[model samples]
Target chain A: MASLIPLTAPDDPRIDAYRVIKERDLVGRGGRFIVEGRTVLDVALSPRNRFTLESLLLAESRIEALAPLLAQAPADLPVYTASQAILDGITGFHIHRGLLGIGLRGAEPSMAELIASLPEEALVVVPLGITNHDNVGGIMRNAAAFGADAALFDFASCDPLYRKAIRVSVGGSLMVPFAREGSAEAILDRLAASGFTLIALSPSGASELSTLARPPRAALLLGAEGPGLAPHILARTLTTRIAMAGNFDSLNVATTSGIALHAMRRTQITPA
Target chain B: MASLIPLTAPDDPRIDAYRVIKERDLVGRGGRFIVEGRTVLDVALSPRNRFTLESLLLAESRIEALAPLLAQAPADLPVYTASQAILDGITGFHIHRGLLGIGLRGAEPSMAELIASLPEEALVVVPLGITNHDNVGGIMRNAAAFGADAALFDFASCDPLYRKAIRVSVGGSLMVPFAREGSAEAILDRLAASGFTLIALSPSGASELSTLARPPRAALLLGAEGPGLAPHILARTLTTRIAMAGNFDSLNVATTSGIALHAMRRTQITPA
Candidate 1:
């Protein structure tokens, strides 16, 4: 069982990490990230996730409700409870969910290491220049849902560990293995050399998605919303189109990921 | 050519509909709605869409660049040009896109009328209790991209015509044909009577999406992010699951729609 530390003042030094959280640049806070709400916190505390808990801040009323989760935390990790007003003051926002956790991001596997670790038959999602945090989160969620081996991001893409992205992903950012390293071209070269069929999604592709034969090992290359896959990247892969109707040319990139992943999942030729 | 009316004041009576647009309940604004950004405005002005333009507001600098689109508008329609500051003052926020339009929402066909108008072989998406305007917009965008015949929303769902939804959809709300009427049960009943196969997407569904045969005419029923389809609704339809690999149960409802619609489209059998 975790020890409960009662916090009466918002300025308490131990709770300083939770202060004005919305304003703080929490993304690369010396490897620290804020996990919000009960649902996401549950995932953060799970033994399977690499995130290390620094402390937990909760509303007094929520402690009893979240006892099971608190019990799961390491005994050394402090669980602090405060009045709703003090909690709100400490966070500089009304945390309606009344739960916030400070977590230390664990070391991520290198791109080469991640690729080397993949199974003989694998499905991977490569997001290129996907700058929107929400789209990043949504893509991570889709990657996990479809059981893709990993999500590889180019340097231009936003950090999946951004708080908003993590929340949008419903803690998927932590659950799904991901790595951001190298330029788009470098990553593509590595993927191709690794015997992965690079399928690039574009409106002007050579074939409809349904007509394409499934590759033994495949990587679906996706781009940001408006710009889509860059020309060089599109030229390097087997281009495929989703066959849209009407004048609208695209679906949200995250949605596109889900559809493409599902289609790829169907065509996956598992080894005998 | 649309006539240019020079507007110098924010309080001009002619621009009343554009005043405090952010605060105004633009949805069902007595058959009036606001259209923002260049892309969406282009759709709103299209002859193919039912929206009738009340007026077009443009930043003085933008008028020259948008000459082609302005020319597409009816000659009698009023086109107002104002300085960026004046346009911002009128809308109670930055009109960064430098384009806004007040459009009169045309009559929406009844659910029965809409179903009757669909092609013999059609794909439709029904969103139940989907109150998020952005989700409604995203779903509409996906519906259009995948060529879903129409989107039917239950009365409890938020209006698709809402301004934010339109922007998020990249003006898809204006392009896609959607209607909000009846309760969940009523809409499902209508769909069944119209020779549509009702397939409710749920996490605990019995059959995987890949195994399901495409019905001649299919309607994919979706629920909101949390508190998914009510148990009774799931029991009433042929339940299907989007085989998830991770511990997560579902994708974002809009993303789910895109994936399901894409699956349905592949199996579509067009009549001779």
Candidate 2:
């Protein structure tokens, strides 16, 4: 079991790494990312989790409820507990979910290396220019739920490790195999080089998802909501649309990904 | 054009109806709900929108950009413009999206009436135990995107008109037809009465979505993410699951609804 350390002050210098989260988010997580809520923490500690949990800071009230999860942590891990008031002061937010931890990102391969490593009959979700944390997290969750082998993010997408994204993903960011970094073209090049059939999702794609042919390797590429896929990107890939009703704008990009990913799995995984 | 009324104070009694939003929410909505952002406002003013745009409170700078939408509102509708600071004060939050409106929900049919009125080829989304506004909004947004005839919500579901729900929905709550009321059994009873084939989605459902046969009228039923549908509830409906990999709990209920709705469309609407 991790060691418990009582904390009376929110300003204790021992927790400086927690404060370094967003800066590391911009510069690269210094190998550290924040996870919030017991639901995510549960995943971060599971055997399948790709990352390592380094430490935890919890509100005094949450300790009992989170005991089973904490009991599974590394014996040497430091568990800091503070009053709810101090916990709020430490996070600088009244909206804290009372459970927070820092996960150490493992040594990761580049987007190119990851794509080249996909197994045959692979299903992959590729997101480009997705800057919304919630959407990024949702896509990650969908990717994991649908059994996609991997999720690749283009340079413009938000970090899935951002606390909000991790929380939204229900720890999917930690559970799924993911690699980020590369321009859209760079990522697309790798996918194509690996003989992956790319399906670019758009509100105005030439064909609907039902018509997409089964490929040995299928990669569904989704872009940000309003801009959707770049025209050139669509031109090079088989562009598919999720049919919708009326003249309203398209579905949320994350929701679109879930639908498309599920469709891909039907052909790739469950070939009924 | 709706006349723009300059507002100098946050406490002005003229916006009392906006103040009554949540209180009205728990009750019958007093026939009034709130919409936020220009995107939703555009839909509220569109010809197909069911609600009446009674008033708008905007950040002073937003008026210029929103003029096109405001021009379409009823000429007598009150358009209040306030500085961002006063707008924040009025909303009691720093996160104000700078656009708020009061929408008058027209006299609506009950859940039974709404379901009973569906066309022969109809699609409906039914959410049970869905209390999160974001999920509620996302479900409604998916409902609109898939061209479902209407969304029917059980009593345990949250209001789709909550300001946050509306914003997350991208105006879908306003664009889509919806009815909320009734217990789980009552709602299910009405769906059966309407001759709707209710497909209750569960992670462990007996059949996969890819194999679901098309019904003349299909209602995709989703439950809260963690608890999902009650066991008794599952026994009554055709239980269907989305194919998945190693168990990751499940996809967000709204995402499940989207994928299911899209799958239904392929069979019900497109008939491919």
- lDDT by residue (A1-272, candidate 2, tens digit) is 88789998878998887655545543336677888777888887778688888789888888898899898888888999989878767766643567778888878877867877788778889999999988999998888887889999987888887777888888888888888897989888888888888888877778888777768788899888777788889989988888888577568888888888888777644331
- What CAPRI grade goes to candidate 2? medium
How do the residues B1-272 of candidate 1 rate in per-residue lDDT, one tens digit apiece? 88899998988999888885776654755778888887788777886465688988989998889998888888899999999878878887877478888878777799889988998877889999999987998998888787788899999998888888888787778777788999999999998898888899888878887777788788899998879999989888989888887566658999988888887777745332
Among incorrect, acceptable, medium and high, the docking class of model 1 is medium
Interface RMSD of each: 1.4, 1.2
Model 2 chain B worst lDDT window (10 residues): B19-28
TM-score versus the correct structure, for each prediction: 0.94, 0.89
Which digits, one per residue and each the tens of the lDDT, describe model 1 over residues A20-65? 5776644744678888887788778886465688898899998889
